[model samples]
Target: MSPLFPALRTADEKEALRFGEHALSYAELAGAAGALAGRLAGAGRVAVWATPTLETAVGVVAALLAGVPAVPLNPKTGERELAHILADSAPSAVLAAPGDLLPPALAALTRIDVVATAGAADLSAAEPDAAEPDDTESPALIVYTSGTTGPPKGAVLPRRAISGTLDALAEVWAWTPDDVLVHALPLFHVHGLILGVLGPLRRGGSVRHLGRFSVEGVARELTAGATMLFGVPTMYHRIAEALDTDRELAKALAGARLLVSGSAALPVHDHRRIAAATGRTVIERYGMTETLMNTSVRVDGEPRPGTVGVPLPDVELRLADESDGIGEIQVRGPNLFSGYLNRPDATAAAFTEDGWFRTGDMASLDADGYVRIVGRKATDLIKSGGYKIGAGEIENALLDHPGVREAAVTGEPDADLGERIVAWVVPADPQSPPTPEELAGHVAAQLSPHKRPRTVRFLEALPRNDMGKIMKRALGNGNG
Candidate 1:
């Protein structure tokens, strides 16, 4: 269903989002969302598909402003995937292209909201009613995550779910109207929606969102004065590669106000190298779909190499481990989601009897409060011969190797050792694959023998979803 975009209470005149040749003012974006929201105001549930480009970005902001729960989905998806989401969601309608991603026979998608072409819909959607919405807070989104089930589960995020994120960042990472963000990440994920768009937009900053990430395109946008940058490790690796042939572009990226890396673990080598190459640390942060983001490296202080920095404001973190002090991470805060949509059993399983939301991530807290995420609580790690091996740490170490460009480490069952480290990597050059022995040797020197990958396979690129998360399930099942 189409959502009405709300007008920004504090909007900047200079900063505008450029989607292809078309550029929309803050008012226009708000208007589009308002138009969508107008239609969705009565029904109250909508799923949007416009890619991460200009049109979709506007649509999301509008939904939130209208106080309607708008779900952003991967555009590349077909009727099968969309059908599952719509059937489960029971949205009022779907605001999408003529051949929308959703399956037929699902509810919502009425004549009022459905449009003929890709042309921009009017600011007024629905019955053009002027009934002011209540200050009510229910589910604002049904954010689906990378789960075991073939059909993804949606995390129910409320209006208050995103406030703590902005407040926490403000307490540490300074944001202002002068700042302009280069948002190339997908909108389907929490990072792109909450931090990428909402965070900057809330602070009255401009976001130059791209339909898809392109190194040269992003570099050019930065050169044009986009100040903030945030991306996953793979995106940064590509940025680093682009900077090599385009030194000027690298210089441009170095000029940003703040640079951050998240969504997936950012390799330390890539983190430092990108910083050295572009003159920015690209502060690494830790978060998940359940909790928007709890930890991030400081802008002024030393961003500890492996850690995802300290907990954000209102977020309390502690390790559940008794021995090594590294187990599952537990968080308590407003930024956390209410629960899974229509999945009461899952919601009950998500948290302890206490209020704290049980983040599936495994991490260790330091004396200074900095937290380093090791792995997921449920099967994202390998323990071979009594030594724990996290996919993130090994993958980060692998990417540090000059020949390796992208890598994903997963555990395979072994009789002798409960689980052994197995890595699937994408070399910078396909023809010149990094030798398994050489890669293993590099990891062995850096990590313990148990932590070292027992087997390595070279591929063109790692399997990833629209949000840029490495699909380990795909790899484990050989689907990747």
Candidate 2:
């Protein structure tokens, strides 16, 4: 629970981060974070532009260490979204990459200090008390959701939440000092910040960060050497698509000791393809904004295709209704968030009477302890003519079809059926796009007639937010 960055630095001086053409040692990075934290303490709520870079990483830790409540924002945020977050966080100070990238509103803001990506000066000698958090229960970060379903809400994560997640991940993934984590996910996301930045630092390991990810770019990083590679399903699928045939991505994933996937469902097809391409089973896990991560594919045994493996240490998962094998996934663990910031009403509604965080996700668990996610609490299944249907089931079946590249299924309002399945998809070959009739025929062979999509809409590409999550709500309600 102590400063994780300092812990990593103490463990290995040579621990360095890869940024562009330079390599940054742990000692230097820690010093910069400490000094910058000292400079940015005036902002009661500080918003730091988040991206996967050595500078962004240090800036976040610096703000927190400075006792400024930190809010991580997307770099590409437009005027409206940027204003909302900036106003909500109300940062009196700003620490940003130099140039016009800093908000114009920032000029009027008092006590603002902008630190260039050109690492801050060393502060080992002048290190402020920096108000090292005395208790793990204190808030360590504030991250805003993309608000695809509704307005974005800020989730406040305490030290316990992050530390507990790192501890749980270290055990589940068997991360150690010997490992080098390769980070490619965006920093604004919890998956990138928690798993990419904090998770590695807690285990006293180093990180190799890329500003962006391309099939070829990641391919090169996979070759650069690392003990573990963590990414969302989209990244893994891209890597799988570009790798060798026989050994698949085995040679590409040559240096990695393990691969972990979360942030979104890791489709069965993509999971198998990654294993076939790289000879490494891409371990798909279950987690969300409220909880950093709870379940993951184990290091040793079967990394099943769809299941998110078992719960991590100190975390317990159970169905709200135990009799049914599948129900709301309720969890009790240190890794869970403190609550939504400034929303006591929401906080009260987030947990059950008994205190488990009600993960909106619906899931089913096997006797051997493997768990497969079914749907979201707000929107995972559809009801039609009093018959319930799992959207993932239909989407997965559609994805298996050779012509389908990506698929998302949602239940749409129907006058007769109450709600019916509607599928939006992207074909593998745009020129040879499959007809709705063809897709319906393809899924009917696999899915129950009741579960077959009532409507299929072909999209050049499914509408997804910056994080690559397929926006089913947008597709179904005619919002996009």
Candidate 3:
């Protein structure tokens, strides 16, 4: 089989990764990861303390080099979630940085400390010739899903899925080794660990990770030669808010080659704000843990503010039959996970009879094949009195109001309307919150009258996960 990262052998000693004060070159990374891979060659599976650090990157790379399935555990995960993952994956050993404080959940597991070996003159000289695992179908990583309804299921991703997704993105983004990617996303999720980190490595490019996300940090990296910036909606929202007052931030962002957003939908208001300030449209993409990536806006294509452009090369996408042209996105592609680990029944239900993985995300495809994701099927799809309304459209409408700073919409049981739309809003000013009637009229004016909020609840902030995705279930349960 061809190597996943050929640059590890061919590329010159250019910088490969930068996290905070630490940096590693291709040669140095190979030496460090190769040395660690030799020790992990026969491990059943390894768990990585996925902190946004160079050690975490090196640890995952080492596991990949040895063809061992690596389960990346979120450093900030609660004790319960962390314990669940540990029991579920049953990793033989845990990989962590030196002198790191491990939680009690990982106390019983065998620990392997990942250390910096960049200064070692012959770090790769005496590396053992470990036999590579020949099967591409073998699990490379077992990523856990967010347990919204139940315990997080482990998605068993194969080596080919990662390779296929990265290659397809390379084509769409015009990605090259000369590019430098920058982001401050967490390291456990697919968006951060796989794309933000590994995507650059696959192309022989470098990555500069902001240990913590800040508008100042973004400007610093971009000013220092970073070409691409990756962030979620919250991060972009901050950027949009700061561009007006920070001249250096605006100038630095305007010079960037590409700006990308994912994990959650970027509001059209923020999109327009960033474009007006930076002259760069933020590209959006859609994917999940089960599917590494299905669609993305091409570098060569027009940047539509609200659309997550065409299906990637070799990915087959089709909406389930719907009269309104919006339905659950079902996809068939090489960039798909093998199955949910140890959950045959659940895995069997995730796919259709014809073998397409049901994405559970509601989206519409334009005539030109642009995919505009409406929302999730279970939470964001509202069946009103007689019409099926997507909560995203109404939320977007709510976001357009100057008084609204953040918004999340969900449907609740109502006898009169069958299901009434409820808007959870974080007002722009606490002293003068937008009245329910005024916000309702605002949404009614923007969209149809039926899409207006029947009930409006004001909050200081929306409850969000680590990735900045609103936890709608919390709102549904009256916790927000």
TM-score, every prediction = 0.88, 0.92, 0.98
What is the C-alpha local distance difference test score of candidate 3?
Answer: 0.90
Pairs of residues clashing in candidate 2: 248-277, 249-277, 249-278, 250-278, 360-377
Could you arrange the candidates by lDDT from highest to lowest?
A: 3, 2, 1
On lDDT, who's better, 1 or 2?
2
Model 2 RMSD in Å is 2.6
Q: Please write out the lDDT profile of model 1 over residues 1-480, one tens digit for every residue.
A: 212222253222444466555566665554455565555555677777746666566666556655678777676666667777777777776666444444454444652233322336453453333333443346677787765655777888876667667768866787776788887777778888778877766766677776678887777878888888878877887776666678887788878878888877777776676767877777888888888878888787686777888878778887775346567888888778888888898889878888778877887678888887877766575677887656787888888898888888888878888787888988878888889988998988887666788788788877787666776777763333
TM-score of 1: 0.88
Per-residue lDDT value at 405 in model 1:
80
State which candidate has the highest lDDT.
3
Question: Going through the candidates in order, what is the number of backbone clashes in each?
Answer: 16, 5, 0
lDDT of all the models against the reference?
A: 0.71, 0.74, 0.90
Between prediction 1 and prediction 3, the one with superior lDDT is: 3
lDDT of each residue in 87-178, candidate 2, tens digit only = 76667765565443566655655533434333455545325476766688877888887776656778888888888888877777788867
Could you say which candidate leads in TM-score? 3
